[model samples]
Target: MKIGVLTIGAELLNGARIDTNSNWISKTVIDHGGMVEFNISTKDNQSSIIKALDFLLDQSIDMIIMTGGLGPTHDDITAKTLFEYFDDIPILDEKYWNFLVSRFKKKGFKVSALNKTLALKPSNGKIIDNPIGTARGLHFSSNKKEIIALPGVPSEMKSMMREATLPMIKKISQKSIHSSILRTTGITESSLYEKLFSLIKQAPDVELAFLPSLFGVDLRTSSTDNDKFSNFLMQVKILLDEFIYSDKNLELEEVVVNLLNNHNLTVATAESCTGGLIGDRITNTSGASKVFKGGIIAYSNEIKINQLGVKKETIQKFGAVSIETASEMAAGVQKLFSTDIGISSTGIAGPLGGNKDKPVGLVYIAISINGVTTVYKNNFKSNRKNNKRITSQVALNLVRKELLKF
Candidate 1:
């Protein structure tokens, strides 16, 4: 099945809201053996919505799933635009309207007049249940083309897709597509591709994609053949052994946390320039309290000295962003928090605050285990925000690699 995704929101175009619906729908479609032909984002206007729909239809897509413009607000015009484009009339769903009234009444609130707009469904459409929200999802079909309209809210849209859309697509689709994501840090996308090029060339049936973000390079490969996919995965493990931290697309922090859990160990972090980013990542993982003791954000030299017990002399000699300071910070945190492992990130993330000897984006990540501290230096070339992100990623990877040894 060939599918297209349409995201309609002025907020998305204006950067007020990100259009995450397209990615979710596209991935869901691909997972259910449907090929995503195109993804288009448009402003929340009738003309633009209609035009984008027509453009997708021109591609002869079997289905087009649209998200956004399906609320009670005046700008929410997806249903009206869709009705006009399909030459359909809005049929009031009295059953749903009553249900909505009863739902609101249960919450000790009266249904407002604006809320009634959600009860209107296209005459040629089937109402998709929005169990979690007010906006009802709709599926319209004419001849060979089908259009599925979902809520713009991520949780609502995901629930509707999983409950209704995926099953529907599965029944109509013949092709089965499977994908795997191998996440690797401390390796550039180009370098990873070069290492895996020969293996990729040998597997003609599988498609390899290098997705790079601040976290790392995610090597995603999709294949119709189970054998080819399995072979590609095996070769990837062999080819990129040291760099491949995760075979299941787990984040660096999650991977490290799991390793720590398995080893029955706990960790703490002392952050300087990265400013508690490493701690934030670790605590984001579920059940992190089991392995994460706590963290100290020693952004200032005095805090590093008093809070994390970093020697003032080390900072004076080598600076806060140096390996010596980072190593001391890690060791200090390990001793302070009484953790089995300690990690620290100290760096210069800036467009300014750089000199001849110490430049911006100069990061030193240190991990202390069993009183032995190892520090890795990185000179990332990016703005402050990206430099922070890069430093955090490497810090987590360092923890991950160290935990792997045990």
Candidate 2:
């Protein structure tokens, strides 16, 4: 089935707010074995929305998922537009009105007359319950084409879709889909794409997509046939073995935690430029306490010397961003926490604070695992946030590599 997603909001068209609904709907539909042929974002104007709907209808799309303009305010015209589209009279749903009143009363607030507008629906449309918000969704069918209208608020729309809309769609069109995601780091998107281009082109039965973000790139493949999809995934896995960080939907932190747990090892961290971000990542995973002992934010030279016991002479000789300081920090944290592994990061991530030899984005990372210590230096070229993010990813990747070797 081909689905068309339409997001309605002046804010989205004006770039004031991103149209996240389209992305969510597309992913949901594709995961359900449906194809999203096109996606569009439009203003709250009636004529524009009508034209967009006409276009989609003309394209013979099987279904249309529209989000936005379902508030009680004056700008909320989606309900009215649907009425016009169906050529039906607008009627006040007394049950919905009483429910709204009850909700407001429960909140210890009197229901204003404006709130009554939310109870209005198209005469021929079926009301889809919204447990989270006032804007009740609508379902309209014409000539075997279905249109599902949802509120603009992300949380409300998501809840309604997941609880009500998705089930209906699945029942009407019983189909299954399978998808797999491969997480990778330590390589550029261009490099990865260049290497996988031929395989992707040859795999006509599978759909491939790349999602790039601050952490790394995620390669997603989807297919309608379950067994065929599994086989295709295995082929891709064999094609990219060492470069694939995760094959079972695990995040970098989760992978690191699992590795540590499997090896019966514990870890500690000493963070400087990342400001305990590395530690935060590790601890964010569930059950991290099993493998993570503790961490310290040795941001200053004094803290490095007094807390982590980094030698003053080493800092004086090689500076804070040097590998020598990073090595000492890792070793010190390992000793303090008495863990099997210690990780440390020291870098210059900034628009300032750099020298001729050690420029911004210069980071030194060290890992001490099983009495063996290794240090790496990276010179990244990006903004401060990007540098910090890349530093964290690299640190996690290094731990993953060591764990694999063991």
Candidate 3:
């Protein structure tokens, strides 16, 4: 089915608000095996909306899904415009109005008179209830095409789309779509493409998209062929065994936390340049308290030496960002917190404070497992926030690799 989406809002055209509704609808359509051929955003003005709607009709769209401008305010004009285009006017839906009044009474809130506007629908349209909001969705089905208009709010739209729209979409569409994401860290996107080149070529039907960020690269693959998708994914896991940290698109920290929980081990961190960011990530994972002991923001040389038991000599000799200091910090944190695993990060994230020998974005991450420690030296190119994020991810991936040993 070739579907076209129209997102109506003056705010979107003026950049006052982002049109997340269009993206959500497009993805939802594809998930139900409907192809979204065109997506256009228009002002809430009646003339602009009419133009957009006519364009979709002229293109012979099988379905036209519209979002926004369904509120009671005068600026919300999508429904009135749509009704006029069909050479008709809206009529009050008395049944829906009664339901709305009853619902409001049941909820113990005085029903606002403005909400009555939501019960008005096109004379020939079908009404879809909105349990989450007051704006009822309007559905118009014709022999040649279907038109569905949903509330602009995300939660309300998502609920109605999944609970109502998707079933109808699936019944009309022939294809079945499935999307999967594989996440990896401690490796470059280019390297992944090089290694998976052969396997990707084997699954010529699967559409693959690479999304890279400060944390890592996510390989998103979508397919309409279930059998081929499963087989192709199995090959991906086999080829990138150690590098594939998450096949279900879980965050790297979440993966590490779960692994540690399974192993019944504990973790702690001693952070320098990252400033307890590693600890923050770990704690963000639910049930992290089961495995995470504590962390120390050993950002200063004095704190590293005094609190984490890092040798004053180590910092003075090799500087605070050196591998030796990082190793000591990891070992010290593990010993201090009595955790099975300890991770540490020391870096120079900067647009300043760089020298020829040790340039900015130099990060040394160390992970100590039961007193044995290993460190990795990395250099990233980005702003301070991104550099810190990369350091935390690398440190977590290092812990993840070590945990795989047991």
Candidate 4:
């Protein structure tokens, strides 16, 4: 089934608010074995909404999911527009009005005139209750196209989608879709696609999608039958095991924590330019205390020497961003925390910090695992925040690689 999504709001069109509804709807449709063929964003104007709806209907889409403009305020015109488009008169839904009144009364507040707008519904449309907010969703079936209108607020929209929209879609769409996602690191999207293109083509029933981010590349495979999809995913995993970091929906930090726990090992970190970000990532995972001992933020040369026990002479000779300082920091943290592994990062995440030889985005990462120390140097050209994020990702990837070697 092909689905069309329309996100409505002047704020969204003006970039005042991000349209996350489209992303949610897309993922939901894909997971339910439906495909999204068209997406549009429009302001909260009647003509604009009508135009978008006409265009989508002309495409002969099976379903249209619209988010926004279902509020009680004056700008909320989606319900009125749908009423006009269907040529249906607006009628007050007594049950919905009572529900709204009960909600306001429960909050120790009286229902105002503006709140009554939420009780208006198209004469021929069915009401989809919004449990989280005042505005109720409208379900209209006109011209053989199903339109599901939802509130603009993310929380209410998401709640209505999960509680009402998804079940209706599943009942109408008879296809059963199965999907699995494989997460990988230390490989580029092009390289990973090239390696798996032949296998993907051979399995025509299975649809493959590649999602790339700074952490890694995600491979999502979907098929009609559960058994076939499971078998295909197993085959793909066997073929790409070397490059696959996680096949069980685990993040990079979670994978590292599991590996360390399995080996009965503990880890500590000393960070400079990353500013405790590496430590933060590791500890963000649940049960991190089982493997994560602690970390130190050695941002200054004095702190690197005095706190992490980096040699003063080493920093004077090779600088803080050098391999020598990174290695020492790793080794010192490992000894201080009495952990089986230690990681360290020192970088120049730059808008200003750079030299002729050591330019901006110069990062040095070191990991000490089981008496072996490995250091890597990376030069990333991006904004300061992006550089820091990439540095943290690279550090985690390095630790993941080292753990795999065990």
Task: Using TM-score, give the best candidate's number.
Answer: 1
Task: Give the deviation of candidate 4 from the true structure as CA RMSD.
Answer: 2.3
Model 1, span 1-406: residue lDDT tens? 8998999898999999888888778766777888788989999998899889878888877888899989999999998888887888898889989989999999999899898889997776788988789898988886588899998999999999999999989888888888888888888888997888888778999988888887778887888898888888888988888988888767788888889899999999998888888889889999798999999999999999999888889999988889899999999999999999998888889988888788887888899998999999888874998998888888887777777777
Model 1 TM-score? 0.95
Give the range of the ten consecutive residues with the poorest summed lDDT in model 2: 168-177
Candidate 4 Cα deviation (angstroms), residue 344: 1.0
Regions of model 2 farther than 4 Å from truth: 225-227
Task: State the lDDT of candidate 4 residue by residue for 310-348, as single tens digits.
Answer: 999999999999999999999989988999999999989
lDDT of each: 0.87, 0.87, 0.87, 0.87
TM-scores, each model vs. reference? 0.95, 0.94, 0.88, 0.91
Candidate 2 lDDT by residue in tens digits, 1-406: 7788999999998889988888888777666557789898889989999999999988867888899987878888888898888897878889989988998999999999987778887778788889878888989998788999999999999999899877766766656668878987777788878888888787788888888877878888898877778877887788777778897768899999988999888999999988988889999998799999999999999999999999999999999999999999999999999999999999999878987899988999999976778999999864888888889889988999999988
lDDT of 3 by residue, 168-207 (tens): 8899887788777898776789999998898888888997
Error of 2 at 359 (Å): 1.7
- The per-prediction CA RMSD against the true structure, in angstroms, equals 1.7, 1.9, 2.8, 2.3
Q: Provide the global lDDT of candidate 3 against the true structure.
A: 0.87
Q: Better model by TM-score, 1 or 2? A: 1
| Error of model 1, residue 159, in angstroms | 1.2
How many Å off is the CA of 212 in candidate 1?
A: 1.0
